[model samples]
Target: METLRNWSSLCGYFVFIFLTTVSKDACFSEGSACEAPTSPECFTKNAIETVYNCEWSMNRTDGIVTFDLYFNSKTKFEVFNKTWHTIPEEKLIQRREVFIWVEAHVGNSSCSSPRRSVVLRDIVKYDAPQITSMSWSNSSLSLMWEAPEKHPALTEVWLRGDGHPAELRKETFTRINTDQVTVANLSQHSTHWVQIRQRSTQVKSPLWSNWSPWVKVPAELAHAPEVNVTTKRLNGTREVTLTWKLRSHAAAAAAGVTYQLSDTQSSLGCPCARTEKRRHYLF
Candidate 1:
């Protein structure tokens, strides 16, 4: 009876050891399967610099997991626990397709994300351009904006005329290769709202940037104002009074209009003008 009891106790100890080892191995295997990161996203913001920025998302797992970015046939970037990596311009050949993938490693476990293939030049997104100046000539409006880079670019312009809803009235898109663009046939006698957007022209496939802020362009004066003049003699000097009346049209007498009175003979005098140059502001 004593021998049987001892044999039973030894078998129980072995069973407990086997069960504990199996449980630990199973938990470790489960944790290793979760180390793979999500698929990566990669893009180049502009054609000028041509630097590729890549990122991936990963779930929280046990222990610290380091990442390695692999691209372009065995070229490896040691991300070192970072989710993002910037591939420099010097490491790539332009206008060619590149394959990219990321691998996560922790202790003896390793996993990889899904692979992605893309052309570096085809995935470009430029910064939004800004409108610098606006001018009017007859019935045309000229708009000038700052270029994000020295390279050529394609532009899209949106114009909204007065008395119309927020919808676009005119759309002008072209490969202007210049920062200045002129839109003809626009109404100079009516107000307008203008907005602009741009994309890289040097690339085969490029993305357009977000539209810039809307710019308010007041209506330009279409005709000269009607003036009434009265002359009076005081102290052997002639005093002249000039008064002008704007037309009844709302566009012709729009707010923020500046009326200037000037004389080529240098006869007008005011605090705002020099003695040699005669100029006066009539509001």
Candidate 2:
């Protein structure tokens, strides 16, 4: 009888603890608004808005993490619309980088405390930049990612690829709309994998940090795409209807018939030249 009573009490205590933990998590944002640094009114009364979400690794060996939230603006303060997750380093495949970014939409006003951007990758915990978008054009690959979590500040970005003697492409970010970095004049008809890296070290070799995923790009000098021609006899004489397949969308989709072929090639830059796109016709 005594043991049963003790067990019941322990169960009740555990329930209380679980509820307490959940309640605390639910109240962190509200408490931050009431506490310090964060002005709850940044969403309503000011032109400058601030938003922040933090993610951390309990084990140092874990990989870096990304806390994602649908963002329409660069920075903003909201009652809700925040999320977080941590990724251990072990989960990362090959040699790639993981980034964390927070955006803000300019409020009607400014913040009371001007927050400075910090290097979050090992240098500063919870201080990673935002990845806006990634793409490539011909030999030049471009990266447009968000900058600074809070107040306006100067920033820089770099890129890594398998070019001869692999080098880093750097660019500086000022009070700008976005962070843009492009490494151009690359070889054409060739595909190279790339990743994005950044450093806020104004005007110096701050640090050629690690790279993100390998974003591939076509070779520089862009080959005139590729052309594959085919013809068919008009069910009779030499009156053959000719149609050539080219590497252009307009060429593929002409008249009313759309012709598209997926080549089973190693993409374009795939090391295996055996890679190819299958041909298709819709007349």
Candidate 3:
């Protein structure tokens, strides 16, 4: 049987599962969690610069392998040490993955301790992109929005509030960079609260953006549009031309204009109203 040997290392990042949760605890158990090297000790950790020394451990019965480390700490807490000694640490790291560096001597004569390094990285997290724009049809809504910026990968987006967690009953989208999207098969006259989360391609972990503002659809029957506005213009002598179509009337209203023109009405109406600025009016 080939025994475990030569496990390499990596580094760089904000500590994620390994540091904040796993690696930190692993290192702490060895550093100060225990009483002494020969006996046992539990390592303590801090927020920043809480790197841990590593070693290996093996199951006595089956020879399953593991590693450990130790640290010197000073504390009145009866659990922490004030020093950072690592000489007795060697007895700790015979079989485990280590993040902190310790010294190694070559021979018994005239030797300097060399530091060892462990390679570990933080897993990245991200949130889902929001739906910027949405429009409704009979039983569906046409959606459009900007894609999420700077994420490893988008895993899934879901429409919520319509069913249970398992019976979400909405189509799933995994596309990125396609701002304009379509969501079909919706009930009419009801609101849909959507929540989404993404994952990094590097590791199989989920990162979710904030939930978008809610959107509603008709859960029952629907109505059609009366008219779609396509153009508008202000003509001479209190005349406003409003042109819209998809129905019959393609021409302006017969009145040619409609208004109760007045300058003495109120000075407080609009102080910033603009007129005759390239066939445009602003107020």
Computed on alpha carbons, the lDDT of every model, listed in order, comes to 0.68, 0.35, 0.35
Stretches > 4 Å off in candidate 1? 1-47, 53-87, 91-95, 100-116, 122-124, 149-152, 162-165, 175-177, 220-283
Better-scoring candidate (TM-score), 2 or 3: 3
Q: Could you tell me every candidate's TM-score relative to the true structure?
A: 0.48, 0.29, 0.33
Tens-digit lDDT track for model 1 on 1-283? Answer: 0122222464465222222323211213433455468767665777666588777888857677788787765688887767988887778655788787777887677777777787766767666777766656777777887777777777788888766756676565565455877788887677787888887777776777779887777774544578898989999866878887753444333323445566554334644346343444323
RMSD of each: 12.3, 19.0, 20.2
lDDT of 2 by residue, 109-187 (tens): 1112223333223232213444444344656645566553333334455544456426666655554442666656655
Candidate 2, residue 148: the lDDT equals: 38
lDDT of 1 at 241: 88
Q: Which candidate gets the maximum TM-score versus the true structure?
A: 1
